[model samples]
Target: MNIELHPRLAADCHRLGQVPEGLVLLQRNASLPWFLLVPATPREQLHELDPELRHAVVERWNRLAAWVARRFDCTRVNVAAIGNVVPQLHLHVVGRRHDDPLWPGVPWGQTLPARAYSEATLASFQTELASALDLTPAPR
Candidate 1:
């Protein structure tokens, strides 16, 4: 079944690529290194997915976490699925360093405005992430 992404999420994030688990990989348009794994299912939370799909999500999470740590030299990997604004089944994978703006604090609910990556920088990052994660472009 094909699922649709929410308009807000679509607008706020870039379609980095897609994972084998039928989930789309999105890069948040913020200064910090952030990504989102969104299952192409019409569910609001992880529990709503079938057992097999749930297992896939966990596997993807593990793979993504490891990749983020290695690629970014991040001190921490923050992954969560709290859909306060966009109530869709998606996971946020953030690469955080000790000296980051929100260091020792959560990135969520940070009052600071989003510092978007430059167009060229964003393109370069998308290339790097796609290569590292072995991600395919999401279907239009």
Candidate 2:
């Protein structure tokens, strides 16, 4: 199924690939290890999804959270599905460190210097993420 990402997500993230549950996207800001899973469904909430799909998405979310924590050596991993701004059913998995810029706080609505990933770095990250999650890379 072809899933169209919300405009805000499309604008702020780089398409990484597809997992069985949905499309995986890496946040544009390279400063933090943030990822999003956009499920291929019209449902606006996680609980509203079919049982099997919901389980698959949650399982993937857990895997992504663990992977992010390990890869980024984070002290904590934050997972949330706040759809107030964007109504699409997307799950956010973020790796956070105590020393991170937004330490002791969330990464929402905070204006920090944007650090974009270099093309080479982004390519490398995409490869590593695919391998780690066994995802099908998005077509070039």
Q: Find the candidate with the highest TM-score and give its number.
A: 2
Clashes of 2: 0
For residues 111-137, write the lDDT of model 1, one tens digit per residue.
Answer: 645677676765665567577666775
Q: RMSD in angstroms, candidate 2?
A: 1.2
lDDT per model, in order? 0.75, 0.88
What tens-digit string does per-residue lDDT give for candidate 2 at 1-140? 58988899999999988988889998999888889999999999999999999998999899899889988999999899999999999999989999889987998777766899887876776788788877888865
> Model 1, poorest ten-residue lDDT window?
21-30
Q: Give the TM-score of candidate 1.
A: 0.83
